[model samples]
Target: MSTTERPRILVVGGGYVGLYAARRILKKMRYGEATVTVVDPRSYMTYQPFLPEAAAGSISPRHVVVPLRRVLPKAEVLTGRVTTINQDRKVATIAPLVGEAYELPFDYLVIAMGAVSRTFPIPGLAENGIGMKGVEEAIGLRNHVLEQLDKADSTTDEDVRRKALTFVFVGGGFAGAETIGEVEDMARDAAKYYNNVKREDMRFLLVDVADKILPEVGPKLGAYGKEHLEGRGVEVYLKTGMDSCVDGHVVLNNGLEVDSNTIVWTAGVKPNPALSRFGLPLGPRGHVDTGTTLQVQGTDYIWAAGDNAQVPDLVGRKNGNENAWCPPNAQHALRQAKILGDNVVSGMRGFPQKEYSHANKGAVAGLGLHKGVAMIVMGKMKIKLKGRLAWYMHRAYHGMAMPTFNRKIRVFADWTLAMFLKREVVSLGAMENPREEFYEAAKPAPAPAAPAGAGDKPKAKAS
Candidate 1:
């Protein structure tokens, strides 16, 4: 394998866009056309839509992520991050997970390092906040929620119990809504097993600055979602914001205050900070400015897509905004990656590039175990549904979208089994500390173990 003989295509991230784009490009190209290399900090690409279920014990967190190495067997997958890109020299500085950072030269580049959780300067958020973006966070949240039950059961102090039982969720988008709903369901089920805890004992608070939640769904469906959540004893605080959560004391802008230990922050996501670091032309929100052809503005060989690219949405119109840009969501990201992959190939082969346009199919969200809201747009007709049917729709849509059939079947099996079995509410918080059991067993004995059959005296010698 000589370097001179291979034309290299370097992908910066191994997320949804990066993995799918690389797979599509490799599938289209000839055997020896080019070498595709993907760099990412994580070894697997998580199907983020299942994160809520993963957190709520609906699906195993391990089944929500697909291993990059197993999926992209032909492509060279490097576990690393692209810290810097030298577009002029066609090289990128990659910091490997285990080794020193090195420069990797490529003939072409694909920027798909997806977005991160958008956070505010609210006090105590950095240390106390739990995000719902990836599998690790989802699993951590599941443990945290269950561990809270354990704390409440063991503690006699009212303040500690109240703080442990109260859960505060910021933001009302899909992440925040779905997460709080699933967690509430889990807590309700978990209470049945606890001696002191009851479903009424726990408090679920959802806060959003906007007047409504689930903005992806229309206003009517959003209202239905709010009603469903409120019916489940969830406290919905809209048109308000959190002033501070300093040391777990939450003060709302609407003159409400509460003390809670668990604060899950799912406010929103901003474009990847890595985009701005690349010195590319950025849109107002710091997303890379790309033409409809999916090529970075003013660059022939460089391309971008997914959440990092501000692509034009040709379907909608507005008075002041010209060519409404696509919202950063899974539906758009999945579609954009396909076109972006093809356009990159077209550029490499000197073929004509086509514009990318997609009419949104609509949005769906699961509110709890058997409740949800969905609005499907079909030929100018809007279909709205709620309750168990909508919940099935949400699961059906994302179940098929869970990438590999292996994972899809596993997730479906999880749901199928849930029909007959009660949900698992026990928290394995020790999972985070793999060696904790060993440490406990290895603890120094309060006093050396007495010799077998010894009764308040030293054991006699065998002699």
Candidate 2:
């Protein structure tokens, strides 16, 4: 039979789960047994755990993303989104980036669309906030923060300088804490080059509703992380929330106000909104409901795992926790995707599906240069490390976890060079609008005015 005639496996994302699942499925299935196809809006799969480093120039933005087509050569990669899925017909509606919507029929479906930033209806947040969900945002953030420094140095007005140098980050989770930490370090280095702007002139603030930050690393480490940031002159706001940020003026619930030019919203994320139309069972928080086998509830042919799916925490349940679910993170996503793929292949080939179960392997987080916190779990033994040692573990673990040997080498090389070379502080702000200069110079001159009624009705000529 031809390739098109083979059983079809449709993967609905190109993120960590989608990429690893598709790769695993391809390896497990026999030759010509099934054809794998992955669809996502982006052509590449971004290693989001490395996004902060990319934003801080510790790793090149390109290395943080893995091109789908290049890595999955045997699978069909579609640069489009699965707008809706109809299990009744086993078909999905595909909306390409620049084409009309089309229907794609498949025998198997993998729902791994991933998550989007969770935001509230706050005043001016939509207009002034930036997100760290994708690689583009990381690059944009790097440029934006450095550009703020340039603005602060050139301006003579006190208010402008204050606003430009004041960076406000909302949310104190991994993304929020790590990002503000990395960005603050970058700005500190950048200030050295600016004659007028010094590190003391800038203000860095982290706001979170939770009492402690880095809760994933446990409360003790969280407190340590908090103190570490505070030592670096970062104001850590606890048990508070952002009320408003109108016109770069931040108003906190505690009645504190600051005019900040940069507002990064990394509060949290919810499962992709697109999952609703997929006609699948969703949990309370909008994640696809799945069983231990990674198969969607009530469906054997459909599967989901990752930030988008609500998978049971089997280890937690066995340990006497009746209500436990896996948290959304790269650790589980990587492992879940592997098991999800195995289940898919098993379901297709008349084999028993494997149940997914794994204990939490702890967490590691890097906070700027040579500052970090880590918790290592080895069975019954739990080892905790902090400071420079934790920083090395952060790099070593993530450096090895990074997909593709090519990217791992590139990331390590970037770190090696940074050890001896001065930090990169130049701000390429125009990159955000690269076409502006070209448009001004090349846009068609305004049509010569109809000074002599050039566009008037030519009744005489017509007659």
**TM per model?**
0.93, 0.96
For model 2 the local lDDT of residue 269 reads 96
In model 1, the worst 10-residue window by lDDT is 314-323
- Candidates' lDDT values, in order? 0.89, 0.93
Clashes of 2: 0
Model 1: per-residue Cα lDDT over 107-200, one tens digit each:
9889898889999998888988899888999999999999999999999999999999999999999999999999999999899999999989
Q: In angstroms, how far off is 389's CA in candidate 1?
A: 1.4
Question: Which sections of candidate 2 miss by over 4 Å?
Answer: 1-3, 444-463
Candidate 2 global TM-score: 0.96
Score residue 37 of candidate 2 by CA lDDT: 94
Locate the minimum summed-lDDT window of 10 residues in model 2.
454-463
Candidate 1: stretches off by over 4 Å: 1-4, 317-321, 440-463
Report residue 1 deviation for candidate 1 (angstroms): 11
